[model samples]
Target chain A: MSGASRQPNGSHAGGVPHDDDGVPGPGEMGGIPRGPEAPAPRPPVIHALRDAGLAALVAAGLFVPLVGLRTDVGPAGGGLILRTRWADVAILVALVFTGRLAMNLWSAFRPAKRPRTALRAAQLTRIGTFVAPLFLGFAVLMPLLPWTTRYGLDLGVLVLTYVMLGWGLNIVVGLAGLLDLGYVAFYAVGAYTYALLSTTYGLSFWICLPLAGIFAAFAGVLLGFPVLRLRGDYLAIVTLAFGEIIRVVLLNWVSLTGGPNGISGIPRPSFFGLSFSAGGEPGSFADFFGLEPSPTHRAVFLYYLILVLALLTNWVTIRLRRQPLGRAWEALREDEIACRALGINVTNTKLTAFAIGAMFGGFAGAFFATRQAFVSPESFTFIESAIILAIVVLGGLGSQLGVAIAALVLIGGFEAFRDFEEYRMLVFGAAMVVIMVWRPRGLVSTRRPSVALGERKAISGDLVGEGHG
Target chain B: MSAPILPARNAPILQVRELLMRFGGLTAVNRVSFDAMAGDITAVIGPNGAGKTTVFNLITGFYKPSGGEIVLNGPGGPKPLHATVGHRIAQAGVARTFQNIRLFPGMTVLENLLVAQHNTLQAATFFGIGAAFGLGRYRQAEREAVALARRWLEATRLLDRADDPAGALPYGAQRRLEIARAMCTNPVLLCLDEPAAGLNPRESEELAELIQLIRAQGCSILLIEHDMGVVMRISDRVVVLDHGVKIADGTPAEVRADERVIAAYLGEGDEDDVPAAPVEGAA
Candidate 1:
């Protein structure tokens, strides 16, 4: 019980005391100077130019080697020679200068007031109800559209995979308030499970899917046992180490996992018992349907399959949010001390969150393996974990729609810039910085409570902790 | 498991015997002993750092005593709490509030009470599947839980702000909500640490009335308060502590008359010595 007692400083620290008289603080006064005597003073243009010039210089220095300079081996197996992409450097420098200039102007002229949470909540509700459905409908019809190319289908699959991963991570990090930096480990477990089971035992995709989720959940439980007492950054660091351990094990375990060569020619999921193969056995999808074989059929089927799984994940998560366990998860987030005082078993609550979140990651990983028809340690890297985490953060933690939107904007946007090659990551990094600055909490920061007693007003994210459990 | 043992009638609901707790070289609670009778309001009063909270932490299983036993007398005789954890102690029918209010600030006022009844609803929810499916058993439990929460809210005069976040309530109201939340566990014994610490005069008066009401509703109360007025008016028995040791224990009038109790509060100086009767009235 002494161990069960909350960390003494944990609960009460950083709590904003409620003022009985309802007088707003200086920062909450709509950002307008009250009882002001002085007129507004804008920054001088020369100052703005100086700030922009500094930004340009820094940008030039950073990009000159990474983007501006490239080393190339001489044509025939000769010594290396320097190759410069001056155009790339100039484009980057100009972008930085213009961005800095705009920021300076906006800082000087933009309204001092923070946007009203009420107005933002209303706008989000409108978009959530109207625009969100339209986007979902477009996703549903994406493969069926007349103009869809194979490349578009492939990109769609990639985007959806990350979307599912982001949503899965959201359950642990966003909803449960556990900062897991090693979520990709569970994804790897699921992928490897499918790879090993289907290839060795000749299990079908349907049979192995549930097994993958279970195995990943077991891994989650194993990780949960030793780390239940840790909180915040300590918990995050352990999870990150766990992720790396899983990756390294998968890399070196050659006998079972095929070493670095990876498990390949992993079978694709069939349309029920009907294979999507062309030469068409009696049970092949095309022969059974009495149609000519087409590669698009399998691609479209895979799209629909993943769509159902992702949607099911979303549906189950939304339902879990209202349950006692879900409330316990959130309560644990708000105050673990209070939660224990309320007679909650902290260990059980945390384990459930980790296991469930990891379960979804497992399902997504299995889908990924089947889609690619390969399983490799290379795919489950720390950067992949970082990207999925970015989606959750950029979307607003604990937000379902936000995660989806973030995945689309980040993963989809990255794919859209594929032609930029090395420059794409540069743009990607810049866009991430800009978006974070624009919305620090996230793109959709307002929280919609799972249950409400009366009118369900969305709460401002300001009141919520930054995912502490 | 062994056979269940029944307790004698009219026995004390809680017993702390020879409790000893040491932190390094310092003994925070040393050889303390007390029996809080059923259906009675017992108050523990002391100077700052007299280990009043440390004692509460011991009984509620926040800390394991270095030496001693805390037993809760249930229908099945005394249950030793030395082996129990905080949540288990709560399940064994002892509940308490912190000296600093520990309400879930993010949760609505009513939700705070609902969380306190987590074990009951959690059982009905069948590990969350029943709740997810909105089964009749889960819904019924939820209805009863909400009803109980509303009832307590009404008693605490917090019904009007039931949907407001508990953290947004005034300091006094947050204290009341914390008490209400602890009561929602439906414990046989309720231990409150400094329940009147930050309350205004009117709020303290109302709190005195609420304590009586809760006691009348069949829950025994053990309170720790620095406010002598509330302690004297509401408490049927008083236990005084000084420097982690019990100094006095008796009826309010009896403890008020103890010379050691007077000396503990006042100075040990000879000139400050006075008859305890006038001091009680003055305090």
Candidate 2:
């Protein structure tokens, strides 16, 4: 069977003929000619074995969380309980397969005319599509659900926070082509800024948010001045160092930051005079708003608030990408010398990109502090930067839609696999490797040329030039 | 040269006085001095590595001259133009092209031209922030940029491909497009390096005509070309360089007859050993 599979024409291998050029000449090309066809090349068994070994390793990694869970539960209770969770695994697998299949089918039958309408429809579908899993989790697939409803809502809030962070980072790394490993430092700054201001000065969340963004923008400018001449790897390393410095300062400065323990009891966003807590009065938000007295309301509100912020981020980014400053960033990315020749002040351009990107990060950070009602240095780490960068790369660098899609797949997938606690990170790492191998340029690889001085058009023909200038 | 324009009684529009540019131990341009009169085509010709491009770079501010003054008789008065960077030089009405084309490859042809006029656009008061937000001044700048880009594209006969990436054009078209992009900056002195290099015979003739047309627009052109046909046909004055020194500078006929130029082309002391390539029937 292996030999038959290896043959060029399995049943008629002996009838094939070889030409000097390796391709069949004239009669051989036209019809079956009796001769020795080229010897069928054997499959590389070692390569196949290596691939199988890697796959097994990845599979083995998925059981790590289960092992951890088993140890926690003890030998008597662990085995049977682990067996029951297999149903949840099957449901997740089915959902992922269905999503892939649906995407393929939808793309195949997509309409050609009314392109604008189609684009709008596609966008609406994208926005509304997440409702499916949520509906299934809450209403339909109850047995497959691992956690109680309360923890599920908490997972949703966490995912929303990262989604906002991803969108903010996308502005710097994706649109501006500036590698900012220190982005989380700005986030930490915002959270601490809000935390300190509200706790000491008694400012509300609403007032502190914009103030935090302003402060972060100033910090961005401070960082930008020192690294104006740096580019590529040097710039990345400097920014990484800057992030560490911010974290270290926060840790060492005992008086201002409360040292490593971080500020606590940060204020939550309130609706007018009504608080979310039950003891505020019998006719507080829960009674007057005709809602259940549960912490889920606050979680839901924070989720939607972040959703709005994320939407704003997307809108502002799209607008900014079409503006002159945005074009200047892209020009600087393509060629700094040419950008300078065009009289673009490279220093100002770099600083603006840094400031704007940091401003958005600050907004998200302020929201995060309010949402959690606490802050800490542990929350902002180098791993957070890595995850944000991974989202941008996996989404395809310099593409807004791609970044959003990447965040959904990565952050959403990570959250969805929470029940498989032992295997979750393993699965995430394996997926990243597989993705890199399959699409080295990322999920949506192609990009439009940034400068559209006139109307945009499709680029045709190959880039033909010799020697770099 | 029929009495020059601006400054002194008959001062040249641009005067390079004993300009010297050194890179560490090597001197690229050694006390090279020349004057480009207004409304004339001055050709700088030399063999490979004869420092023709170095002269152009010094004049256009790509490299800072080690010594001597580059004086430009501005609309106000005669002044020593400081050895500034490329963008500042471009703003001072001196534009240049590279020996190898240096266009923004990923930008559209129109964008390439628009970027040339970036400094000229009347931006908003607050460092272009107000304009960037789609304010009135920004809208006008956009309209003007579009119009200017279209005019140059038309001039280059590349209007149909205006939206295409600059790198996608054919070789000759790319060369012409570079000239058009420079012209969009409204430069007083256009320095073209090897404008005829790599062009076919027909394209070379067309390029000569384009240079003549630009000269007709009252813009002084300083061209470095290896093609004798282009230099002899379009140049009102030709300066010959050898070993980083000016060997000859005069009208095409006068420079062609100079024995020093012949020696530079055929090499000294071997003039009898090697037959010189017949100069293209002197245009």
Candidate 3:
């Protein structure tokens, strides 16, 4: 085909409109009258009614059996007594109708010209830069706050662990564009490595931590090799299978692992050579610091330790994003065929992303085992993997700061919902829906390009494919 | 007539001998062959479904040839590319652009070029150790990489848009940027697929000059084009293919004069069914 044929400009040389066969051409409509002038667009009353009716039906189906009718047995005679909670059913139906109506109104009134990049992206980045240190300061003082309870410090440690895991998965899913649905397997490896080593050989947490990371990274390499040729859904399925295999082995292999009951009594990290223990022992941290023995001391130490580790994860990730390997990962994510055409060793780039990401996950896992003083297969299930993946996704993929904020908000928010008991997951699902509809590209939609020609400008996340994640 | 075609002053930088590509029963390419002399612009032109792109794929190592040899003359020895993988072929000094522009849309114009120099910059990173510490050696290499990127950017007149995402640039600018990105790899041979497909007259003219500029800088170019005007103006040699077979290969003037080439382009009349000539390159 000629080059001009491909032009989108809608022009063809030496062309004339014709109606030689007496079929009226596009510009020659004479017999039919044009319809009335366009009516001003009306509010979607019918659509709202339809939506409310559908919602009401769903509400009725869900709430009718539970709230609409109730049966009770008579205490003495064994006769049946029935009671109906009509109010509960009405409340459920009303809530559904109101929610549907509100959604319709919001959609109608929402601004039409949504810019690809949010206008407030720069402002948000500036605020993030300003608030980051303060956030870190708050984290550092969280355990020391006047209202700080043991639960607060424990929660802090949990949130930090997840934040670290999110950052690790972000390297694979975000930067490198490899969809890994089995990241928790690496975490399991790290935890088990420390548990087995410490329990078998009496090695300390400090010694096993790096060793755990190495083992996890090695596991990552093993996973990377077989899945190198797979992409997108295939890669995800294979990784998910790998994670399940690891958990199943941990569950069934009772000799090395403790089976479903899990390995317990894993040692907590000591303060270098000084253990955080009771009494005035020469080698105890409390004795050396001349302080009274308190469990809070150990809790506070773990908080700082995890905080440092999470920050290290963030630091290394940020540094790598600017390095050659990091750039290669991003490039591989953007267009793999193009990356290969550019002479990048795709196998190596993918492997590095996997190994480094798993290394961080392993470190977090080691900390987890020590924090709980136990290792279990249940802790490394597919759901945990899903949560970390969700954090990376809901945090706007490659944005490091986004991952931490997402982890804290999601994990801490879930923990806060403990009061709701059975309804916690329901509320969690609703929050996820609302957040996705509100900002589909996650909380932060701007990603700073790895290198900039002039000033470093953040690109709109909408412009990026979630790296096929 | 069966003697090998050779450039007068220098041996060919790339030679394709009887390259055959088949898909099941369909032979998309049938023992098609040609040679690209060093520092010259060779154009491959054919009608739709002429297996022109299949030939390009075979040479670039995107597809393994069904049979026959594709070789690159290197300093050390002949590099048999039919056995090499796509990335290794690129690393062996052959870089190519796709028919549809495949610029890394998410990356900035500058990052696209930086990625093209992945091998060199990766070495400087010392497997990421040197970069992790911001070592002097890695930093110097990075600086050089950036400098090389800027030079190519300036050459393509895309220095102003270096910070802009490659996808956001206008179509013509993206085409130029793709060339610049390929150049950043410092390729010995640049294969461009339809570089002028969507360009206006002015842009195509600019593209012709750009090809000349790249050739003047000691690189060889092999382009696939449907635009005869572009092919006629810039190509030192033109290879004509029809129905997966090379009908003519020679200087532009020589191919323009061949009867089979004329029959291929302008549909053959009932009285003028010219038999195809053997593959030949007039150096």
Candidate 4:
């Protein structure tokens, strides 16, 4: 990481004569304070003005098309046309100019020798103790709130499903240090398993859930075996290929999967054997309980079901991290050669990581299927895998709470940007870049030791190497 | 594997008979053979690239010997390690540390020891599914593992730093932690690849004491070292290697006086009768 700070100086090294790297060294000319090359510090006002001007120029260049222009259909439905919105562009540029000027002034007047933000490990771990449960409470109580609209409940279900997926991938990418780019293959497998079994064989969603997980785990082990010898980029490429292969198979195997059209009208989960049907039908939840029938009960049931499943995933992952196999996987990530030297069966360990990670992916897939009442090839695209991978990584690998919060923030934030139309991805992408630059290891970068002897201290992420395995 | 053999007195715990390793065209270890007895600190000292570490690697199953056999006489009798799978070699009662420190830097000191005992805990956890639920047998197994790690940590004097990351320790402490980790595997034969490679005199003295302690516990040792101060003091026997073959083997004092061992250390011709080997003390 110390090596990383060099880039900041390197970017500005074109004109600046960095005598001793970037850090100002001791007085060079026999302890003299100032040399001929040194210039007196400029006034803060002038500096701020120059910076704002440059920032306005750069902002104008950056927002060339999207800023001042709006594209829409002509007055009628005749043809497409462009409408210029110069005021909006000017406002955006002015905001950038002011922001840059303020930033320049702040830096110019700030005290010297300030502490950096590198002490985040201590603060984040301290926050994790309370932040995790506080978030859980809010999530649990969300649906019951009177203000939570039906759309809000639906979005909660979506976010929780992703949270589950993020945790599942955390086992492979975060814990085991295997970069799996094709995790959605397992997701697709689960969805299709539930879809095909329920639609064709008349199995209940409950029966197919476990079966879906088993089949996906089988797929995991299958994929794991051939790629056991691969590591790093090779493993990622192969897994990415596996995900694509699954999607292609689902697309072409139309009789089994409905091609691009997908399988629909899949059964929703019941209150046990009782369906959540309206009009008080026989064996329906309302009829069995002798209560008022409302569709909200079904939505609440699904929310709680997914909440339970996500918690289960979280619970299982925490337990596994302290176990021998979990330790072996982590050790393998730390130093595979050392792991082999210690008599660990690397193949079995790696396989189990993949299987378990895929197993959860499978469960989440089943949930996605039942929730949507649909299974389509289009839904299990590379982007889903990328988003899940992004969630796992951006959450800080192996940190469960971090992954949950990251999923919520990312999914909910993505949804929040839905109104931005095509610019949503672009804006979200810029946010991700800023985040990566600020904290490359994810939001929860400091890792809590799996087990501790005394008062637990968070291990700095710098100490641990990514499990290139 | 069954535990039936009770070795005769002075028997070789590890017998390497004409082990040969060839990587493409280079003979890294060529037809070398030596015996490490039941309770001895046998040091293999040679110049750089003299196949000292190569022999350790071959014995540890990092490489399959091109020919001949390497066997360790555990409580289960002689197990041929040459043909066993790479990982099973560790299970076959042999453990080794690298020339460079290879501690899992991210893990706690105790966790490093715990990982070495994974094959044991893994079975007790029923392939670890039982562990995810914190079920019956796994809890006991993990407790036993922690106790075992505690023992090694105590032995290596790392108990105080047990909670610290392995990488955060001082260099000498990391070396000790690596040995502690290797010992946690419960090996009958321990191979130390330059165990004292980067230690100060006092630290090396402490390392020699640790080696003696490991031998006292009935685990035989095979070490590659350049530190003659350590070798001359603690090693019961020394095997000198030159260009991939064993040139001399005997008590450290006897090997120290051998002409070829001197030549290997000094090159071809004599330099006015000066002692060539950095033997502890010689004017």
Highest-scoring model, DockQ: 3
Ten contiguous residues minimizing lDDT sum, candidate 4 chain B: B274-283
* Residue B211 shift from truth in candidate 3, angstroms: 1.0
lDDT of every model, 2 decimals:
0.83, 0.70, 0.84, 0.84
For A375-403, candidate 3 gives per-residue lDDT tens digits of: 88999999999999999888888888778
The CAPRI classification for model 4 reads as: acceptable
Q: Tell me, by lDDT, which candidate is best.
A: 4
State which candidate, 2 or 4, has the greater DockQ. Answer: 4
What tens digits encode model 1's per-residue C-alpha lDDT throughout B1-283? 1112324435688889999999999999999999998888999987778999899999988888999988899654678987789888888778899887777776678778888888998999888877777789988988888898888988998876776667667778888899999999888889998887776677778889999999877788999887778888889999999999999999998888789988896345542343122112112
**Residue B94's C-alpha lDDT in candidate 1?**
81
Off by over 4 Å in 2: A1-160, A272-274, A280-292, A419-423, A449-455, A458-469, B1-11, B74-81, B120-128, B131-133, B266-283
**Top candidate when judged by TM-score against the true structure:** 3
Off by more than 4 A, model 1? A1-109, A112-120, A467-469, B1-10, B266-283
Worst 10 residues of 2 chain A by lDDT: A1-10
Per-residue lDDT of model 2, residues A1-469, tens digit only: 0001110111111211111226555677767766878776445444444444554455445644453234235467645443235555544544544555555445445675564343453454344345434532442333234663766656666655676677787767765667888888888888899999999998988899899999888888888889887877888888999889988988889899988899999988876656788554564677778777877667666766776787677767766655566666655655666666555666777888889888888888899889888888888888888888898879776666567667778887887778989999999899999998887767655445434544344232133111111
Worst 10 residues of 1 chain B by lDDT: B274-283
What candidate 3 gets wrong by more than 4 Å, as runs, is A1-40, A43-96, A109-119, B1-9, B268-283
- The residue ranges of model 4 lying beyond 4 angstroms of the native Cα positions read A1-124, B1-9, B266-283
What would the per-residue lDDT of candidate 2 be over residues B100-130, giving only the tens digit for each residue? 7778676678767766766655343144556
Q: What fraction of the correct interface contacts does each predicted structure contain?
A: 0.48, 0.32, 0.70, 0.67
lDDT of each residue in B101-207, candidate 4, tens digit only: 89999888888889999998989988877777778888888788888888887888888787777887777788899999999998888999888776767777888
Residue A343 Cα positional deviation in candidate 1, in Å, after optimal superposition: 0.8
TM-score (all chains, Cα) for each model: 0.85, 0.74, 0.88, 0.85
